[model samples]
Target: MTDSTAFDWRSFLLKWSGEWADSLPESETRDADDEAARQARWLGFPPASEERIAAMEERLGRQLPPSYREFLKVSDGWRNAGGFVWLLAGTGDARWHNNESGLADMYAEHLDEDSGPEERREADLWRRGLQLDVESDVTYVLMDPEDVDDDGEWAVYTWSSWRAEPPERHANFLAFMRDMHREFHSLGARQGDTGPVFANDTTRELDARVEEARLAALGGGWEQAEKALDEAKGYSRPRAAGLGDQIRRLLGKTYMVYFEDLVTDPRYTPELLPPLVAEHARHTNWDDATLRFQLRGADDELMSLAFETLDQVRNGTYRYTPAGPFGEAVDRARELARWGGSDAAWRTLMDALPLWEPLGPDHLAPLAWVADPVLGQLLTPERGRELLSTPRAGRTGTPPSPAANLDPGGLAWLAEPDRGNNRTSYRFVLVEGVHPEELPGRLTDAGGDGGGGMNGDADVHGADTVLNAPMTLWDARHTSTADQREFSSYDDRALVAVGRAGTDWSFAFDDRPAPFHRPRFVSPAAAAGVGTRAMVVWSGLRPGHRKPFFHLSMAEDGAERYAFTYEGGEIRRSGEIPEALEPTRFFGDLAEGAAAEAERPLLEAVTREFGASLPRHALTSGRLHTFTTRSWTRPPGQGETYTVVRRDPPPAQWTTGGHP
Candidate 1:
């Protein structure tokens, strides 16, 4: 007997196909239990024992397929479909069919050895392969052992009894059953049936409807979501009960979106509270201890007290709704904010934006309702003054390029002075000491004799060796600062000067007045006081489009710092690095400087490029690897860049078929 782990058709029928049958209308389905009992009445009904199967195989001089063998273990022969579907032969029947050519009598008659040459030739081929079921109506249902794929998986064919030529083929028995099942359902549907004869229960459909409702609610279409849930309730009472829990969870998420929006918006008003509070209470038994639930039914005085209570958004002492410790509410908002460019990219932002407007110039009070302390302080009037007093960072000698025409609205809004004068400013600086022990002098040395490139090297040295040397910051092309028709420009000479100076270097500027700004000072002390030491290095502005190129600051550090806007641009530093970033140190053998924790993003980029998780041990273990690649836009070898790899060799840099 095959172990249960191997296969048991009995369980499979009851669990999979049986379950599907149970879901169908009574008129079109059979219960598996009843089928089993009926099958027991047939001769050899207890299912062939393993010894019987083995003895049959011995006589046939061939092994049965795994799926078929597994099926026989559970059922010697099935009495399914009143025996009309097909009569499966057991061990005893196997010999009579094979030796007596029982298949030939049923299907080989179609071959007709006396047929015309062409037809006869094709018929002979079918005769050689066809294995017919004794009980099937159409000889079409048969297995063609001669028609096997490279994997030795025989194809099953359905043929017309009148013609012995090619028959329609299915890849295997499983596929044949699936198509048959589908045909059965489709036939029933066409015959005025209410549902598919072989269809599974409404679980799949129910799950889909539930997901749709949740998404609708998240996107603020609450009415549509409610309607969806009501419709879902009709699928099945039992299933609907389970879905009720999911609906509540979704409702909870929806409430949080609105709750945080009301709490954060500086232009909040008492008028918005009634609808939100009322809806939350109606949807769930939330915050019963506080006035939250009461406020839902509150008259003027009660409503006023509710407002006063909720106004203190950060109060942690109260035992309210089952949904406790609402700090995760803000976390969820931030998660939504980070959904950049995905399908739901703008969902939360759009949902929350209308809840509260920004405080106008005349409005200066801190939004005490904001539970997040950092966010609350940023909205204060005094903070706005301090931001304005700060000097912007960026070099100003060059004229604004013609390409800088587009007003950087959203991007510029990020740098507003009143919101935080320094908020609009950006900074770019040189991270000291983070260099490979030995940089590759020549590109050829990294790649093997094939001379393509380093196949893969798991070491800091290997990575640096492959890295394309950066263009000098002071190069005339980069530093010209000329008003060219195209805004494609780089000022490498200044960077080279900073690199040579040996001190920490950076550029900072608030983009309040302009989308692009020049650095006002090169002093490190000034960089230190501006809240964050990071800087934005403009790659260039595209003419007509007026699109400014940039790289996010914290996202790049160490060797990645050498990367520029064209390669991977930098963005302004926002907030302080939780800890001082250690510059990349260049030591000969034990060269040691950790990639800043702030630069984990750069590490993540490496991981993504390699298509795997890059464990910290791989890098720290000194088994890191590297691959060198060049930009197609630049001259061959000119734009060479070495990237780090871990555990495995880096992917080759050649087009398929060996074309470079």
Candidate 2:
């Protein structure tokens, strides 16, 4: 069965039209008026009959992607819609050649080999493609049928008619639509022609209110949390409709945190289990760790109830009254327990088992009466700790990577390795698969630092064979390397390292190989065997250069070389001739001037969301050098190299770049 959370094309079209219309001002321009008339016409058109869609597909010799088909079933054509997306044809308008506003006809115009030089060159590449839109004379978006993925979705690209460069890619039609929608709304909002997208003062206020509720819920102040959540619902903004869900999740946290208080209260008894369990079921998505710790304090009866609820959920017999959390909880609990079977379930639970509170013998006597075997096993504090210490190895039977358990202080693991390759050499190798072989080279070119070629004649060692040792083997490696002699003079050349454990890989750097050491690193994935990439930033003051330089890179080997210094709200980034770092759209061009606090929030928000607490670089200007390695790998049991680089600035680039 398709998960309930699966994207619904029909719902999206409805919401898109409804929200777009709602946001538009009542007074319409000629364009808006024309669009409204087209909308009215399309709205009155019957949903695409299956027969019509089939006939259209037969004539076009291609099947429309599911999203487009769904759009057809709602409206025959997108008129005055899709923001800057221009037009999307429905069945009757989807014919070939010169037929009406048909999609094929639009694309066919771009395939003319007899056109002028510029037009012919522009049309050649898109001859057999699906033209999505032509927003400007220079820009045309198209879906290349030849570049379809495993899922049968074509890769969409923005073709710049005059640029000799390759077309910039988007993942698919749906993704391209989403990006265009956001881009249009963002630009429109900036120009004062539109209000904030899906959020305004009311939504922000509601979010703040929910954050307050979340805090209260965490502190066991259930009443206060519930009240704040209620207040949030009074705001009639479209986004506030989810306030009730927020309240339910808070209530779930309340149950977990104050389980003991509720269990012993005169108003409740063992019968309260169903509702309590169900309430928590609604919050299956919550990642609050405090609840996990508090759950250990639960009494025997409460523990038994939780286990019972878990069992019922796993067995498919659990039912929630009034359609509460049962559905979500069942799926969530199965996911948490890695529900291969009872054993896997038990082990999964144990991985998160907390230390039980100290209790008198009288209180402990009742634990024997508990019927859930897993619960009883967990009650023995030592046993629970032991079980948690060594979770069941995954399908590969490899223990969870030590890198997964790194603390924030262990940031040293992300430092550039001392490439002064001595025994202190943290020289690790990149095992090809973690990133496409072309990545390091491409980044090097983009940064415009041929590294070895940067200083005209300096021969630099690229970071191709860098590999990191896991914490388990760190002590041994450290002790063995303690006696290594330091090089007479450290090379000015920058060193780049890739850290890995199990299937996880990340960019890491260390100033020099230090024998006595502890290392810390963060995997961008933050999960065991699932994270595909990581990033690292390292810098120092150069001896003769007299300026501080930092190198920033992802799992991709090339690093952005820059010298940064903050002047009030502006960060002056200078070094590489081509400007290595892309200007962040969030704050515009920093050099153009901004309040110092403007970029702080963006960085802080990223840190909160992704734990990317990289060291901030304050320019002190320098010669830039970008280095990369063509070879790298650690021994097999040592660590697994990632094949993709985790894109910077969080989600937007990463999502469009096709890295999960």
Candidate 3:
């Protein structure tokens, strides 16, 4: 690390110029009349003479801070210190902030009784501090003489109107400037722009250090590599930022690295992305970090490759063979995978990660098995908890468990009383051997509305009349809208949304109240006509109902195979129950407890028996094709009692085609 006392302002400003010039808009560069095109733009003004510096200090009746004084001796003032700061004031222009702008008084008037002591202190300092920035966008840079360190270095602050509460404070002027430099690089990177490279000693040295770090990582000197990359990033080197991210991913700080100019370079993509994509596939929820791979401007072919790899993983066809020093440990994992010990294989690979080293800067071995077709499925909620609960090399504490974030497959979400909208009631129909695309139309027909106006001609009445028309599957925008209304129940006119569960199974979600709430009302004919097995599951815990109820009805080929409804600690069973229900004690005498206690276990047993699962996201946040059903009309009597159980049923004022 370089000494702060002997900081090289000239070299730092030189690097700042390179970044500034590169970030200038193309239109500005094209116009000769633009200030950036007229002269040596972004370069600092000539150094202030000692006499001038002394005169300014004498006028202010205070000695200037050492770092700021040295900075003026090198460059009187700088243009474009960072993207947010347009210019720094020179000796001739610098003044006390209060003298020019009475911002302290303005802020004081707004302060209330709730304002804390820190806020008051900050407001007072705003009046006394020496302002450094002459031009900026709602941003101020000031040095406070009252808050000096032992070395006479004044505290520096960068404040912006958009920020909340306290401004960012740094130990000294040098620290503040360094942070600004880093911000410039981060801003550029986020905009998908890598600032122009300068072939100066400073940049050349940083680039060399990056290369050395790569070599160190390749040779298993991971700690050394991490240190070098960390140092390089302090200078805001774009390549170092990308490489540092990669090291963090490998060292377990994160599960993936994002796409960046350097990280996604053809030289690195082949090694870096395969394992990252694999890690992504293992996740139940695609959080922002994992979803960034599909952002605009990402490599198209790489994304295609990621999707194809995921398909292979799901189909149990993807394979990987580790090479070099990592080969032995990874091969052991592969053996475990082949022997059907998938969870063991994942644990084995995770255990060897600390010792495994990259074969080359562009070669990431061993980790590719994370995307291995069979092994990827091994990262269940249980394994995720285990991985997160254990501290890894170089990590300070146990990592946060992603277990809760992991998708609890099948009907697991039903047991969570506070899940999406917290309506305390859920009804869904699961069908096997039906394509997701075909379910909406089939469900429409089953609702007995002559295909629910899928041809766009059937009369429909609801908040979203367009539901009668076909829509694209996985409508992300609509899903996002639904997710935002977390506290509001679905309107009475709401219908069903369909999504795929497994390779050959589809499920429908209905959030409306009864008599539309029953899965039987939605019709089993849809599943039977297609000669596929289907199951309808319903559970309600709304207060004041005669009893909280759990219902399951299974149908195969136009016939009811088995059915049961458990309410108020009583269960009614009919037809031939599957053997899977026996282990769950579904038919045993009721225990003296709440019926809700047995709901989850029964749902799990049914899910296992039918080999069906619905992604929680599909119901909570994911968008799916929607359809309106003829649920408004009562079906002809089928020799079974139909009851409207909700205390707040649809208003009698609403017509239901003369059916009551």
Candidate 4:
């Protein structure tokens, strides 16, 4: 079966296995004794003989520990139904496995219309939760690109939707993403603030500032003066004397916005801007636009963190109480949900309030997601009416527009008037972050008083729908940014600029499941620092009495792969791989692993763009692959900007029709 969504594995595995296992009945429930007997069979005691165990191990190319091989016989039927199992070709660790619908496509290659008993028996290992070797659907992997930790802790491995952003499994992934984002934020945040942040009043401010700056320029022909502008670049600066000086004011404004101390400082030089010019920042407005544009962008960057925090409050995703960034945003979101906005938006806000608060016995924050099915519960039928009833935030505000002067009190205030009555509409963005997949056939299905922008058409169209149905995961992971507003002000069907698809996939601690893998996706440096060193190795496949057991480890670079195998239970470094083991097959076994390692560095803005289904006309999605590491946590003294994508390509450009 081909499972279109790769992200569904966790839910699918737990759900399908729990149900399937529950269906099986025990013969007598004496598992302890039965386990021993089963091991005896597998180990070839009477049912299993030492000679049989030795012969079986020989065929597999390795000897099994008496304890491990014994336990396999009594294995608990099956509880897992996805990842790393006996499939047609590759024996897991690297190849892809399609469950729902994709599984049908691959299996069709080896089997007839139906699977036989032997196929079913082989499949049982997966269902019963047997060993999970890595699978090749690796999104990305990598070793530390810089300093190699001799202790071997610097490396990261991660995977996600292919459609998602590129994978980034490297030695220093966690540290790397953070290092990159800080600079990304410091510089990019200004772009949104000055250019297009969805702040309180975009149009009015832009218009007002533009006019003021222009007038100042027209009057002062040769005099330099400082002024701010809201139009175009989004900020104002002191114009130098003369007409030429006035026009370049916004450029100066942007410079100051990016490096606050630079322009404002008593002694700053024009040389600071030279670097930008060399990087193709034409005319200087580049500094202004890039800086402010990214402030709003931060919203997008942090939205996932916010949803994750909210999810924890919603789903209890972790065992320990998480005091992470997700927690902070929930507190902020709850505050936003309670905020009563201009007349029209109030109802939507109030209706979404319940989804805002905490609930469920597990106290998991995500259970509120269950309420998403019945969005109708969020509305009060009088919310839109109520916005009009509440007094404005700070009086003295202008009425929405001469047309919407429906504000009989004349004390009306709308967030934006630029698109007033034009095809565009505005609403306080935060309410319920509706996932597109979760959207009902119609807006009313969620909680519509009838027109909160639902055009009543069978097919949904235009920018208007976003106000009524905002999505968290869809909105969060669907776009990329230097800051959070990119997510907050997101109006299009965006693609996320995740360092890697996400922080979900990880490296196992000791090849055992308990402390299986730390859920935290960290930097390669941290990974190597974590203590356990599970190497890549399998032995005894060749003749001349090669070692039969192998242990795993890596060199400083994590590039040249090596293993330590066993000869009579003693560990020895066997630098060379066995002759019998095919190099292609060996790499195939670790297809998942190597891919994960290779993808580490590329994850910055490559992964996390997966599974994004958007209309062609709305937006052109793309990746910011030129991420140059920059963050407060990283060592000072930069080689290249961590946030800046390709120096030449710039990575700011996008593609249409879902082209990569």
* Candidate with best TM-score: 3
| Best candidate according to lDDT | 3
Per-residue CA lDDT of model 4 for 388-427, tens digit only, reads 2222222222222111312221101211222223212111
lDDT of 3: 0.60
* Candidate 2 segments whose C-alpha is farther than 4 A from its true place: 1-7, 32-46, 80-83, 92-125, 134-138, 160-168, 193-417, 420-660
**Across residues 21-108, which tens digit of lDDT does each residue of candidate 1 receive?**
4534546444665455433432225767899889977876666655556667766654332223455455665432231334444444
Model 3 earns a TM-score of: 0.50
Task: Report the Cα lDDT for residue 553, model 1.
Answer: 35
Q: What TM-score fits each model?
A: 0.26, 0.30, 0.50, 0.15
Worst 10 contiguous positions by lDDT, candidate 4: 508-517
Q: Over the stretch 46-71, how does candidate 2's per-residue lDDT look in tens digits?
A: 58888888898887789876555655
**Candidate models: Cα lDDT each:** 0.34, 0.37, 0.60, 0.26
Clashes of each: 55, 30, 0, 152
1-660 in candidate 3: lDDT tens per residue?
A: 325558998888777776556565554434432365224644587899999999999988899988888889988987666677777888988888873566687668878999998778778878899999898988889899898988789999888877764678999998888887767655654554333333445556777998887655544455676788787776666566566665565445554355344535666555555656655655734453444543334577866766676665544356665555446767786554432334455667667655554434544223454455434444444553344343333333433333343346666666766544545677777778875545554454333442233333322333223333222223322432342322121223226666566556776666544533333444444343357777777777444456777777778776777777766666677788877775238535555445566667777887777777766543554333466443433354544333332323343232222123
Candidate 2 vs candidate 3, lDDT winner: 3
